[model samples]
Target: MNKEYLIRWIKAAGIRAIKTMAQTAVATIGTTAAMSEVNWVMVASTAGLAGIMSLLTSIAGLPELKV
Candidate 1:
């Protein structure tokens, strides 16, 4: 792919990753009974993992983008 396509893919992947991370974090936080009892570290780690997975998935092939 050319530089433009590559750049677009990267930007899209990054946004996807951020969205995934936010979703994961929110879901994880929801699992807790109360906000005060939430484990910030665990939520962050889980979200970070999700973001990495998103990026990896993008590398494989972004379903949202057509070939």
Candidate 2:
């Protein structure tokens, strides 16, 4: 793969990871007393899901932006 393609993949993955983490955190906030008490499994699963989604989207050549 080319350098530009690799950079795009990395950017997409990072964006996905952050978005997943935020969503997971919001979902966990109501059930947990503190951030430290949040479920590890949920966090890991969210990350994994984000990674898979990013990879799939990248491969599918989906537009990352629209205006």
Candidate 3:
């Protein structure tokens, strides 16, 4: 329940989310490159979802700070 611990956890979650987003982006790009037919809408949706998830996770993790 320490504030520092909570901050660390939040930071870790943010970092993890960012990392996941990067990984997903790379995978999608690679797949699209290999497959001539890529869905722009799907890619946009995926990126948006990933960003939302990252923000949500970061926010949720903030509660641990008890601030």
Best by lDDT: 1
Better of 1 and 3 by TM-score: 1
Per-prediction backbone clash count: 0, 0, 0
Which ranges in model 1 have alpha carbons more than 4 Å from their true place? 34-36
Evaluated against the true structure, the overall lDDT of model 1 is: 0.91
- The candidate with the higher lDDT, 2 or 3, is 3
Please rank every candidate by lDDT, starting with the best: 1, 3, 2
lDDT of 2 by residue, 1-67 (tens): 7778777777876786577667765666546646467676776676567656666665655376321
Residues 1-67, model 3: lDDT tens digits? 7878867886777777777777777778778878987777767677667967877767655554444
Displacement of residue 49 (Cα, Å) in model 2 is 10
State TM-scores per candidate: 0.87, 0.50, 0.58
**Candidate 1 per-residue C-alpha lDDT over 1-67 given as tens digits, one digit per residue, 9 for 90 to 100:** 9888888899999999999999999999998636668898999999999999999988988876776
At residue 12, give the lDDT of candidate 3.
73
Whole-model lDDT per candidate? 0.91, 0.65, 0.72
Residue pairs in clash, model 2:
none
Q: What is the number of residue pairs that collide in model 2?
A: 0
Which residues of candidate 3, in runs, are more than 4 Å off?
A: 37-41, 48-67
Scored by TM-score, the top model is: 1
